[model samples]
Target: MAAYTQDAILLLGDSLAQGKFDRAGLADRLACVYVRKMDVINRGLGGYNTDWAIPVAEQVLAQQHEQHRVPRVQLLIIWTNFVHLVNMVRSPASAYYSPNTRVILITPPPVNTHQRTDRSFADTESYAEAVKEVGAQVSVPVADVWTEIWEAAGWDELACEQFLFDGLHLNAAGYEIVFNSIMKIIEERYPEIHYEKLQTVFPHWSEVNVNDPRPSLVKRRVPIV
Candidate 1:
């Protein structure tokens, strides 16, 4: 069998990261946009805060290192609830173990209290600020979803509901904001790794020669140094 390989974009967080709200969540939108260039992995754990995610994330990085898979991590996106912002921000730093692995800390979006009682908008904002502080301390990029979504909604509570499926989780419109923000960061700071700039695994079908197809199908092998 041919060894399969691709770049990776890892999503780690709670119910929001897991895409509990919609079929097409953050990871899904990114996958569609970066199709064939990178594989988007969703490691979202429902109801688990950042404290629980620390060890799990460490193990995941270790496993990836040991496995020596073709799909190396290019981007690691993390977003979780406010209850454990401090630990969550500190823990995901281990992702740097893999060289060239870019990290993006996403703050949870604003909550619509009318929909649920598990959390409050004020509480979530404080945590979002905490996440931004962590991102700055670690020198990692932050999506700041909380601020972006609220601004997009013109800071109106009722208007913001369109971005969320429930009081806490993001809906399609909300995820789009995140996806755009992330891509903006990548485009500005890490243009080299931008999906549009990367080459596809194979040439476009129109570019392939019909006769003597082996030359088109097989790549020239390079000698190991």
Candidate 2:
């Protein structure tokens, strides 16, 4: 197989971003959509709060300049706890600093106390709100995951459990909600980068003329404007 490099969509957060509950987490789901257009880099630090993520995020950005193989970061999605959301969004030096790169802040989903003893839905909601507020202040997109999942469950606490694996992490269904929410914002705000609108590397097999495949197989680069 031939090896190639493309721009990246960076996913930075905690366990949820790491896909602890669902191995095919946000990054995986996005990779399926972007296909060959971009690489989805999951820099999820399990059990990490925003304080730790700040320094790490800077390192990732700095290292990007040193590594030629590391594609430029086109989009950065930060899905951390409320405490970190503010710093991540407000700090101008983080990954979101680039004018060429877009950013999306994802608030954590509501937790079900019945199934998990560590977190509470009430606290999650508060944190989610802070994320939204920061996003507004920074003019960055914010995905109110807590609200989305809660409404999807018809605002029923017990019904909300369907979206979680252990009341803390998300299951497949829960991840779907997060994926859709993020995609919706991307479609609305960054339509140029939308996967559906992106051109594939090569033409479909049926579209290629066996006698002159190269002419049909190669596509010009689609600049992000």
Candidate 3:
């Protein structure tokens, strides 16, 4: 494993990491609990999948020196599934990434509308499985957002109706929940980043209202249009 003494988080992936929550911004809430030395960068692009992650990764490599034994510039929090690009980059994956990079793969959550009659559970499961499969190529840790919250009241579930202002995006509370889950995963699996105390990325975050709007649970299913 490449060891990086730097304090930073490089988030890359799809719109999910881009904060699809309404009521509570999942990534915003996450910034509070990092509780360590790190810089968080949200590089998630809407509509991106695994295939596209390659070029992005390549661009990142350009900024690095081709040398080992050096600290990494950032920690990779990739929330992508560019399956289209996988085949192109799979062989000699070393060409795509620098030795100084550490990776965390976040699986795509079930963005499909869940109706009692809709049978797309399998698709979410497949997305989760795809995350694991893709991670194998890069040898990175995969955060199975799909498995973590797939069964947990989706758009079809009454508890999740209001949770997602719309059918796919999460409300503030919804983002908050997912944010917490991500923190727990980082703490447990990625001990290197587990700073003993809360670390602040933004200097002004302290002045910001930490609790302007307290988190609340909403369980009303939005009617299907």
Question: Highest TM-score: which candidate?
Answer: 1
For model 3, how does the per-residue alpha-carbon lDDT over 39-151 read when each residue is reduced to its tens digit?
45666677766667677766644332343444233456666665433333334454544444456666655554553335455676687787788777656667766655555
Error of 1 at 180 (Å): 0.8
- Give the local distance difference test score of model 1: 0.73
lDDT-better candidate, 1 vs 2: 2
Higher-scoring candidate on TM-score, 1 or 2? 1
Candidate number achieving the greatest lDDT relative to the actual structure: 2
The 0-to-1 C-alpha lDDT of every candidate, in the order given, reads: 0.73, 0.78, 0.55
lDDT string, candidate 1, 1-225, tens digits: 646456678888888888854576888888887776677889988888778887777655544335365556777787853323323334545332455567778888988888867778898899999888877776777888899998998998778888988767788888889889889988987777788877655656776889876678653221110
The TM-score values for the models, in the order shown, are: 0.84, 0.84, 0.63
Q: Per-residue lDDT for 1-225 in model 2, tens only? A: 534446778888998998964466888899998887888899989999878887787666634245445456678898864435444434566443355677888989888888887777688888888888878877888888899999998988778889998888898899999999999999999888888887665556798899988788775354783
The C-alpha stretches of model 1 lying farther than 4 A from their native spots are 63-67, 81-96, 218-225
RMSD of each candidate relative to the true structure: 4.3, 3.3, 12.5
- Evaluation by TM-score, superior candidate among 1 and 3: 1
lDDT of 3 at 59: 66
